[model samples]
Target chain A: MSSGYVPGLEGIVASQTAISMVDGENGRLVYQGYVIADLAEQMSFEEVAFLLWEGRLPNRSELDALSLELANHRTLTQAANITLDALPTDTDPMDVLRSVVSVQGVEHRLGKPSVPLAIHATASFPTILARFHRRQSGLDPIQPRADLGHAANYLYMMNGKESSPEVVRALNTYLVLLADHGMNASTFTARVIASTESDLISSLVGAIGALKGPAHGGAPAAVIEQLELIGTADNAERWMRDARKRKVKFMGFGHRVYRVYDPRAKILKEMCRRMNPKFYELATKVEEVALQILHEEHPERPQSTNVEFYSAGVLQAIGLPKGYFTPTFASARVAGWSAHVLEQAAHNRIIRPQSEYIGPEPRKPIPLAERV
Target chain B: MAEFSPGLEGVVAAETAVSEVDGANGRLIYRGGYLIEDLVPVVSFEEAAYLLWHGELPNESQLDALREQMATARTLNKSARGTLMAMDAATEPMDVLRTVVSAQGASKSLTKPSLDEAIALTAVFPTIVGAARRRGQGKAIVEPRADLGHAANLLWMMHGEEPAPEKVHLVDTYLVLLADHGLNASTFAARVVASTGSDLTSCVVGAIAALKGPAHGGATLAARNMLDKIGSAEDAEKWLREAHARHERFSGFGHRVYRTYDPRAKILREMAKTAAPDLHRTAARTEEVALAILHEAHPERPNATNVDFWASVVLTGAGIPKELFTTVFATSRVSGWTAHVLESLADLRIIRPASRWVGPEPGKKPLQLTKR
Candidate 1:
């Protein structure tokens, strides 16, 4: 066993994955053989999901079949439906996703990770969130429409009406950009579960939990919150400087990887400008000031704006609530999570990493009666 | 970057005082540096849990307070119960455990992992496990008894009768033996999730998902089933020889860490002789034959019999059905999982490890959808 301790396993190469790569030095993201930029604006969310799961982009007929399968699996199981209603109306949507997804997958026996399971789980996330959103607002739930594309159906289910084509297009791009990113903490969580030969839902439930943390998929809401605190473009520098001096983190700025500007962030920055100009105006100013301040503090570090920086503006423009941000990230990343699970199951090993003990030497315990 | 280590076999991910698996010497030490053998004879499962979370065993009054706290938290909240009742009675018990626990802990706010929440989470496990067990048996769910201790209450709720003292002792010992092991896969999963600054429920949920894997906690059920297949002591040699010819891996005979007999398995082996003499007879014969065959194939390997091997016999004697084996494992492991999360809270870092990218070059442009 390697006796060296790697804090956070930062430089440890845990797995060899073909699904996605974060080319941090070059500022590129690759899914299968294709660059993320090529897929972002041109492909539908379903196409990107297919590519992640199968290692290649789907053709026209294959894309149709995949879309239909995702559409068909949108309805929740009886257990999942009841579980959804069981959680409090005000419960965090991420918690709802974690609980409902667990119940939804409980009916199946522990089966190997497969594409069908991935598709079914990917399809259900939108339905789970939409239903929970409706219940919280005392509105009747809208059934998922088979005719709509993945992003459109998600929007339709949430609001009982179809969104504009451009809005749907923006969402598709956001989903595509966020679909997968190498072995991220959450994706690593999914793969770790899959390496144990656990089923797809178990892997996904674990991933959801990991993503709900404020560090990973939990960043979009914080980005929005920071922007709200800044309030306007005119106040960007002063407010951010004051907030930093008060020891508040400039949310959505730093990332562990990405030495150069993130590819997804570059694309979302453009989308924000076009779709949410007001947010774009204020956010760009804050991003500039935050980056400059961060650079001054850590000049040697690769401190740059991350994907979550502009994702808040884009998700808000697409009409999602702030609290739904992390769960929405889960909805997108479930594609990556399940794909990683399948890849892991195909070549499985139990991921039982060692730990260094830092405790007292072995000692005897006093008997219960003898204890004071 | 360090070379890719599959399953992170030798990688040391964290430094902790919670517990240690000193595999080379076959010693298992819990918090406060007490060896497993010393603690088992002196404390109940609750006291061990208290020790793991608080770094010391509770005194008499503290133990009494813990019992009362556990007793009060035994009942499932409305949402969790509704979700539990919603599942088909025929569903797998581990799935029920993962789902109901998720629902039970669902809330509007995201809270940090805490010691109090850990106790509550640990207390609720028996209630869910018992409900799932009864539902699987096509019997009515039983409410928990406040007067009974943790292990006794588990048997009482599942069987709806007074548990024999001998049986309760076996179950309690099993729980204590398995409660904590340093950085095992499930505990690693919990810490990974907790590193994201996720809530205790999220961390525990991730741990349960990992434990459902056949290579982890599910091995107990597999071990028992393999014994059932052997049928009797007389059949052990023939079954072992044939299974070896077929290249079937012996389920409970090998472990990666323990070079000698597993310390917990050693204790359980002794208890199994008295707890289920008939099964122990068959298991003893089967272990002998299996070890002989394994050694013949790989002589360099250690003489290995993991904790699962004997846990099966002991759990069987305690009257738990085979299907609930993983859930029972989770019932004990939630303590260790939450403990790792809380320990991790003092030094939280997002555990996004580096990945070895094995993919196509990133510059490849996507062909248009119609052209493709």
Candidate 2:
């Protein structure tokens, strides 16, 4: 039987996936049967990506080979470089990422999505963002270093020098946490595109477009912006209460899936406390006030800070400009997007869902000349 | 806890007033109550686009305003031009379209999707399509004429000359017919992106990426290629027999929604007689043979020719190269894509669906790399 319209497709199960699961009730994120908490601090982004793609942790040799492959594909295609140079300096980095990634993955043929291709697409995200960021800053682009890991190489390419171990570790954890979150709007966009047997780049470019939304990957920067508006910890309650009265949403506060606290946010919150003491201090106060207000209004519903809330502080601590927050999230999530694309392609079907027509009953039309 | 629907086939994911595919009765309905067959004779592509966006057909002054708005937005910005020139002339047209559109739409910050933005996005497609084609042939880019109508201008930019009236009518009709087909993969991709509250350009870009798939917009080209391989009407039966023997599925002969002949296909089938008489003759013969073979294999199935079959012949008549069939489809569907995005804004929600996990049980511990 055909189910009735499910607005936003809130609880509709679309596909059978082995990649990742969002256990909302338990506040757990599982990637390939392993809990996210176990992997977040320990596994590298490359290792998590490998696990997502291969459904198992890679041994030393396999990890090395995958790293080499990713490092080798780090350089942008010639067309991608030209396309990158073509974008205006003031353009949003997310748009730059979307466009450059499209150009970078343009192929002469239509090939089945494979791990090698996924590696090639995943490797280019950082280089695209970093190169564009540098070009905007009036600096020459820094080439990617093969010897460095994904997180370290991204910082090296963005800045002219390497980042400290602490910052690199934070970025790696951010990437690992954001890698795949099971059937998210952007990941669903990727799967829906891939469900049609589209190319991996097409699926990814589509996902990037989806992620640019304020409700999705676009929120991290908005969080920073909201926090900036709040200014200081002492002003937090007053500003938030006023903003709430004006019907302004507190950025990064509510999530659709999590009935409890998001596990990723809990980890990023701790990191923010350690690395960005000032932002952490202000953010903590704001969070407390916001949650108190939210709880006052909704009493029965769970109102906890989401990943984007603490992610703002963490990314800020890592020295990213506010504009790069969403794109940085994209850089990490490309691994997940690509992994999901591979999974969707492995057991492919065209994801053509129905729509309940709310238009008028069909009738004859007026001739163009006869109309007023 | 709902049953997992593979491909979301019968799940009604949206409530849309944009258009409706009443596949049961073989009817297609556009907004404002006009049937597809009824609307085709009265509206130009711009008018069809206006109807989709505003839910009503424009009058004389309104249509003029739309035409003026579209003409003003036809020229690509400097960044878009640079991006267009950046691609290899020989790159796939859809790839070029995807990248160039993203570059064109790249902005300094996120903006909510708007009707004005939709019109601007719809107007630029022909420019990118024409530019890609001209570059592929090493021809100087032809500037779009503000005085010409949308279809006429597209022909002018692509051919560098005034198009015959009949040819423009043919192309315009094709555009009108293919403008929207209720929640199809590409349009669904657009809505999913829009549901995240993404910008209009991101939604359109994502739609274009999904349209690049062979299973979706690429079907027109495949249908045309199949006919070309068949060579003539005489070889139709032989080709069908051999293809069937080899277990090859006929291109453009089957669809997911329609139980009878597609209404759009019926109209295009009749138009194909005069548009490209010779190709139409071969296509007609091929459809007959293909249907016969398909029926022999599955008598229970209600097999019919889909829109792509006749679209190929009509497009060939309109002088679009087979390589660009999908891009041409994008040019038409951008209006519907943008319309869906705009409609989605009234009640925006993230289209995040649930996934049934098929992997091993969660909470598994990972082995250390050296130990593994």
Candidate 3:
């Protein structure tokens, strides 16, 4: 047997399904057998969520029911509220989400025999987002309105006011774009935790913890910081030159899976254009400058704008606070985190990776008094 | 069968006044003497930080010296400042922290030299974070004031002016509450990295990265979000009912280690009493309602509130924005991260774990795909 199986296929089923696919070689992403572009443009976040969860677009009644369910669960429990109020204001939103999700496990349903826990995750996700916003803003959380769709209601609850159509569309697109990626670290973590037969909250918490790592969920915010440094288009080249000199990895340019282009970037680019043409123009210029420098530095590596680069511009245009960019990403990716956790549970197996041993050989233990 | 443990098992031997973790029970005790709650209420953030780093409460002389050292370290290197300024403003603060931290090792010497080296290293972190924050805000980084105390200087750098005594005191309390918490995942991770004989900066960098995980340091953001959703105490019970029905996890009300209570929660509860009295009352009432519901609904788990729950309330009452919750956690926990790293370095053993072989056995012949 090979020492390392690059493509881990120990128990992967051969059956084809309409969930998602990662084309690493070509750097493409597709959801439910549809290209990300198609879905981001034609569908809402709720529609994509239903597609991922139910394997197809929801029918009108199913969609409405799902939306109402999501909306109804938007507010947090009193205990959760107290907890939310207790956190340091400066805590990272990702960490906050992680803790919040773990607490959910306390009340999670564990002994069900029929429907898997992922369904419960789907039902609970909107509430998680709602509660997160409420605690951070120091505002009393808004109860979800049953009449509203999930995407629309999330914005309403977030701002404690009605959302504009444009804002809702932008947020919906962001959610769709981030709903899933390939088996990234957090997804792997979720699968690992799920394999232990631990509860879904534990799995989700594991995923959240994984996502909180700087190498993973910290990208969107990094992209924003990169753009700010470039300042005007005039300084873009100089900034790129200096960044390369310092060997700093431009936050939004590279991807582990997408070698050529992040398809989500394309969709977000479109969203930015729709949101504010001027800001979109500046964003495009920023991307052009970054791509140009990347091409010059390493032509072999595909370095194009990823979702984070476009996400920065899109979020800024929509009036999201600069600090909240990553938090917003968390809000959207919770669905993906939930989905991966459920998938891991369905075919539970512990995820324990081997390491190349490079250490001193085992020796006789010394007495503790002599160790110092 | 060789007994295998997936996680590392060993000893870390650095002397620290920071936090202690009881992994078996999931309790985190901060400092040599005080419980996390006691410190949070009675101590200023600066005093807590001093206690964690020095292994005792700072007397008047020690406090003055430490404050001066921290203030002096607040100044950012030109290169580091430029780098921070260059980052995309929309970048996640955590990501910015990571990048800056990774770069900081080269920019400054954070190694353990004499007593001076350790003090210098400890002092530089607030400067790093403060400078990064300023650069992100499109403001020039402030030089630390030698005249002020640590907490006061940090506030000065952050807000570009000296803060009121009350504001400084509030920030100091926050620092104390967050300074250390036993051997949590991030702290353990830091120890693991340090065990490899890596430098202090690398170990701290790893710890920060680990702590960024939602399950560990991210709960504050989740708590904030939950608070945002409920809007007012009047809607708390209804929100709880729906959240329960949906099976969504709530933030801050449960913990992995503490079955009865999280010690930090009590500290924060008290802080909230003085800082935001109205919010504190509401939060306390909310906790009562949540506990009642959980007792009846989830008899098996019977989860209770933890530190994040009350911390969120205290911070929100202090007028901190929700998005910054995790950032605040990062600031306070650096002392713990540093202590663990130093301990790991002192012990000087690589942390390697064994895994149960679940993949194809080494001697197994490869099966042909066509045959399958």
Candidate 4:
């Protein structure tokens, strides 16, 4: 009965590949028809990306080509670097990403009559990430290396050094975890923009802006801070208790989608173990303490650990600074976001919903002087 | 020349009888006499929503009608379910809502009354959020309970089981706290959409896009990140100093609207006091340290703690995970968004803003020597 549609029937279907599937009854997740568990364990982030776009696993040659292409595009343009350098250092990373993506659109001259969506994303993603890292590190952007892998090249540009296998693996896992989720805010924004038949860069810019919201891609690093507050297990219960008293929300626990467990949590937990055994132990202890307290306090709510819980641990164990958690999330999520934009574009339609107006009814004009 | 509504700086304050913003004094009074805390203690979310919409307390029958209407609207269509199921499991839940709501416009019956349809349209919002989340977890969707109140049903649907009465009440209070604010960005966007006489879904979709911005509903997640970065109280000062030095905008501190203190912070702080006593102490200390540092650093910007600062504490204490903070915000805000949309429909007008065109007025050939 609201302005848009009958409550149950709106925006329910579209023609697109299922980027991810949520089986609410069983608490499971799958991406691009592949079980999340399988992808997290077996496939590289680049491979997962290919799967999302190509609709199947890539052969070795195809994957190698895609990797080379992605790596080649990792370098930012001179104009892009200039634009990023001109931005204020205090700018939120999301805003930075948005601005850079917009500029990329201009610099790449994406407005050219006909450009493929894949080419746009492929060219834009690396440039966006590289420029973002450059700005964050107070350095000028680097040129993309055609010889490196996507993960290796991104790390190279980000840190100005070749990444270790462990680091690349960690980054790859992070990317895989962040790659996609169903109809999230940023993806929706991308889809909305795409519905308008906006170019990929514009859609990506919108998506980046949407991702900046705290509710979306910004909670993983906060989980690490929560753990630090708990410190040793001795202080965990007390700290959690105190936190509960103040009503502070613990990072990385409950999720909107997963009532029982976040599948990504399991994957990240393993990744953390592989990265740093000590931090993994500490993280597990923190989780235990938080869970124990939650169970005792409000057992009825079904609060449990979600992706961010372990993601914080995994990223931290891998030696990434906490500030970069969100940016890293952006890097991985770019694939899924681009994919969703493409999907929306494939069946392009403007996304415009209605509203339920609840303000003072239109009134007769009141004299400005008489209106106290 | 296009007419501009100048000198209408604070006129909206008098027009919408929602909340009185004493920007200079740092106070927000909802309705005529009710302080935020006063309402927080006794008012249910449904009651608060009615007050915002009708500008008075709803009678029992009116309340019942609203409840029934919301209940009836809670069921999501199969198409929406499929769409949600198709999303990446790791994608942010709010993004999913934004996309679904935007796409929802296409499925509506435009011939129907916008308000009546909007009410029904928005009713299913909680279900969409709950269902999408559950589906991501691979859990079966729970059917909405006709007998339960709005908050109670939402919790039940989210968890796929019944919630304890106390938990229900807690969620209800949380929702009440989030129900509405003045014309914040997202609500303004909703109004913009409604002004065009578009459907409710479009308004809500636009509002969701706005809410996805970090400066808006995303603050809760950012606040959690700040807490995470600080780890323990001992680390707070150092972290704050570094962050400030780095020019990172602290999430939970400062506000665009409230010059002194966010009133919602007070209410949530009290609630945290009752629910999680231990977290309360840490949160209090955190607040103290943050306030001291903020006061010392930026004496000019009235760096009063806002709703997000305490809301994060309360929700964290209540054992809700950090990732859910923004989702919770969305849940509470949906009511306000719907109310604003309904308000916009009362006097239909297109919200088309004109820009000051500084370019040459009409097409003109360049003065070339050869041409001359």
- Top candidate when judged by lDDT against the true structure: 2
True-structure Cα RMSD, model 2? 1.2
lDDT minimum window of 10 residues, candidate 1 chain B? B361-370
Residue A276 of model 2, lDDT score: 98
**Candidate 2: Cα lDDT at B208:** 90
Residue A288 accuracy (lDDT) in model 1: 90
Q: iRMS of candidate 4, one decimal?
A: 20.2
| Candidate 2 stretches greater than 4 Å from native | none
Q: Candidate 3: deviation at residue B92, Å? A: 33
Pairs in steric clash, model 2: none
**DockQ for each numbered candidate:** 0.83, 0.83, 0.02, 0.01
lDDT of 1 by residue, A68-168 (tens): 99989999998899889988898999999999999888754778778998999999999999999999999999999988989999999999999999999
Candidate 2, CAPRI quality class derived from DockQ: high
Candidates 2 and 4 compared: the better one by lDDT is: 2
CAPRI quality of model 3: incorrect
For model 1, give the TM-score of chain B. Answer: 0.99
- Residues forming the 10-long window of minimal summed lDDT in candidate 4 chain B: B5-14
Whole-model Cα lDDT of every candidate shown, in order: 0.91, 0.92, 0.58, 0.62
The DockQ score of candidate 4 comes to: 0.01
The TM-score values for the models, in the order shown, are 0.99, 0.98, 0.51, 0.51
| TM-score of predicted chain B, candidate 4 | 0.86
Error of 3 at B50 (Å): 23
